[model samples]
Target: MLATPPDFDVLIVGAGISGIGMAAHLEMMCPNRSYGIVERRADIGGTWDLFKYPGIRSDSDMHTLGFVFEPWKHEKSIADGPAILDYLNRIADERGIRDHIRFGHKVVLADFRPDEARWHVTVELEDGERKLLTANFLYLGSGYYDYDDPYDAGFDFSEFEGQVIHPQFWPEDLDYTGKKVVVVGSGATAVTIVPSMAEKAAHVTMLQRTPTWMFSRPARDAIANFLRKILPEKVAYAITRFKNIRMQDFTFKTARDKPQKVKDALHKRISKTMGNDFDLKDFTPPYNPWEQRLCLVPDDDLFESIKAKKASVVTGHIDKFEAGGVRLKSGELLEANIIVTATGLSLAIAGKIDLRMAGEPVKFDERFYYKGVMFSNLPNLAVVFGYLNASWTLRADINSEFVCRVLNQMEANGSDLATPVLTPEAEAQLEEDDLFDFSSGYIQRGKHIMPKSATAYPWRLNQEYLYDRKVMRKGDILDGVLTFTKAGANAQSPDEQLEAAE
Candidate 1:
């Protein structure tokens, strides 16, 4: 049965950071317009609220990960899960965004009608009832990962008698205390889970398919703390943000330019910290640094766990699962009371929502990205993607500003819809192979969904903060691909014409 539909000017899917941020921008720009945010979970904070794995925290620094309009005031630069969730909840409550969010409402499908210039969205309520809503604009912020379970390759777990758990679907009641635990995968989740579980488990073994580059640093920023006491809070935040951004920029540049030196330095640091307790080959990555994400070790916790003989890392492929254990391809068997498959997530384009325009299917795989925002020849649509080299919020902020500029211009020019039309030559130049090279699951699934770029920065990815600000925020919005349609001569206003020229 279908329930009555709700009408709104804008309907945003997912109440995560991105969705919430988008709603905030809309409210600020068009206060008179009615807007609603839909979330599947009973609460907000999307991933943060769902993921309850031990040692769950942000992989990046909190200062950069946070929203630009709302600065994270916590003293810890690298915040844990609870702190991050608290920050997100605070932002929603303080901004009065909680009321606008309809929790337990999960959008299943969305279709765009070109004639109406609106999206018909169907959502499934908690009570197993379906409903439809129409909105002028549709924003997807569901993110790339599958929240239900870790997308492990088909391994029959039914045969294994031991308890099996995926970090994405962690059970709160199950106790791991005094139990031999095995955590699989080499990504951030595996790195976090092993150390935390080591504290309670009888023994924790990290089984990885490949080694990843890992670096350890202090989580607390002592200098920033001192500055907070000496200077104003805003000034202190600015100083900390600048220092972290510059340092990250320098580190990424140096690693990219002088690969061998950085790799050697990293190898030496890890070897020195571990001594003769563990083999160096098992911990070192085969590729150069920054080829994949470098794992951050807060306060040397992972290394300390290794030194304490509480954790051990094994590098090999899994053959199959045996009763009460995991069998490695190397003919070695690891017995465990519990298995934690921290494998990885599955990625989906536009949150895997089906998109249509003018009764024709808009294949994301066949489209070329324009400035990493809109697909070629796509109308009334834009995607918010962040920089690979810099903070995700840095690019998202610019994207929001760009959206606002486009909307303001369209209203002033009497334009009913604006679309990006790429030339044939431009479309032909795009290569599919360049789109995905990383080992991460999100990048793999995104290969067919995102734009392929040749270089890392300024072209494929512009990480320079100032450069992006000038090009994306203040640059000509109507320059190349954008095409606007006038509603009617009498419908056009003076403000519309002036905005079009600007």
Candidate 2:
């Protein structure tokens, strides 16, 4: 009851890939609505701008990572970080969305007023100035991983440390040149850093407690290149995107359905490339493929490094860190001048902003995701969380489209409030699943802080892109689960939704 009208119609958090895309979507779909973006950094690109480590590239194909509305013109489906950042900035400038972004402004807290159907957002600008702003809708495209907080392997590397570095905070000036480097963990970051750093380092050693599945792919997508040469730009891009998506879908399905067969094929490829002398066990993962994300090596760079002896792989547990380097559980000692902990990212949703509803702190675990975008009992909020199995932007673009649809639907209904609601009994009946079903340590560690996933429709988020494209992008907006209400009243009950549906 203590809430007032909002100044802006919407306020988007983060000015990265998701935020920039969200701005463009709003421009196309909600032209009448006034919105602004607040980014914590002084730059527009988020992750791409943040991670300056060498050899940082897209794990997934860029064709799918690129926004649906905007076609990717480049030949490489998997692009490097700087290229990706440049592409995002180009998008912002071309669309004229760059001006709407207020850099160096971080949203600290957002208090939702159910009565007033508004949000009072607290933002801290550069130079330590805190200010309050209000908006009718809040869209969070801040991304999943936290830049400031990265996951460590709980290594007692506390002692005898020789310039330990995290991929998240890769120092620009720190030189690994002509030094023996040991990169801990076998995730995407480690794999990427191993080869890139080996180019200059005296010798790079990749020490992994457990092996991760790696796929060697060409840096340049041959099929996409052929299509580009033969077909029109737009048509070629559309075809290439579709082909890549289908290929990813097929590969993922094959891995899931026939784990051993897919495993044999993948392991065979690696064993042949790396040669029998380089133990295949180092490339063999205990878990099935696609259980955790697959690591892609462009042009067999990682394998080439290992083959050329520029880099080596050591598979064992770390007993402790000694004076010079790491002591393995197998009684082997790895001597290194520098240690790079390419562990993984710490998941921080909504830029780690506090969400309060009616003066009460909102519990993420207590809330169910609505269509994987909006949280249950949360009004006029959309989150951009992409698919784990496919390209990130595939889901992000659809989520933006869905958010636009929600806004348009509310406008059409003359309703100022829209919230996804479920009966108490129904929510209680739903079974809880991990927000992300992956064996990745970062995801597992952050599960306690993430929102719980449900089993039923409107609550579950399918990882498949085609399914989401059908449901999220083309599904009915008047679904009974999403209740609409105008100002000066409480949200509609289950009976009201049923009656309206009838």
Which numbered prediction scores highest in lDDT against the true structure?
2
What are the per-residue Cα lDDT tens digits for candidate 1 across 1-502?
A: 0133238757878887777787777767766557789899998888888899999988888777877677778888788889988988898888888899998988877777644556778889999999988876666677666675447667788778899998998898989999988898888898899999999888899998889888877788888888889998878777777788788888877988998888887777777777755577876887888777788788878888888888888899988999979999999998889999887777666766667775576787666665565666666676666666666666666666676677777777756456666566765664443654455555665566655453422224344566777777767887745767532223343235335534
lDDT of candidates 1 onward, in order: 0.74, 0.86
Clashing pairs for predicted structure model 1, backbone only: 412-496, 413-496
- Name the top TM-score candidate: 2
Provide TM-scores for the models. 0.89, 0.96
Clash counts for the predictions, in order = 2, 1
Report RMSD (Å) for each prediction in the order shown.
Answer: 4.3, 2.4
**What global local distance difference test value does model 2 have?**
0.86
What is the per-residue lDDT of model 2 for residues 422-454, given as tens digits with 9 covering 90 to 100?
788888899876567788888788888777688
Model 2: residues with Cα > 4 Å off, grouped in runs? 1-5, 490-502
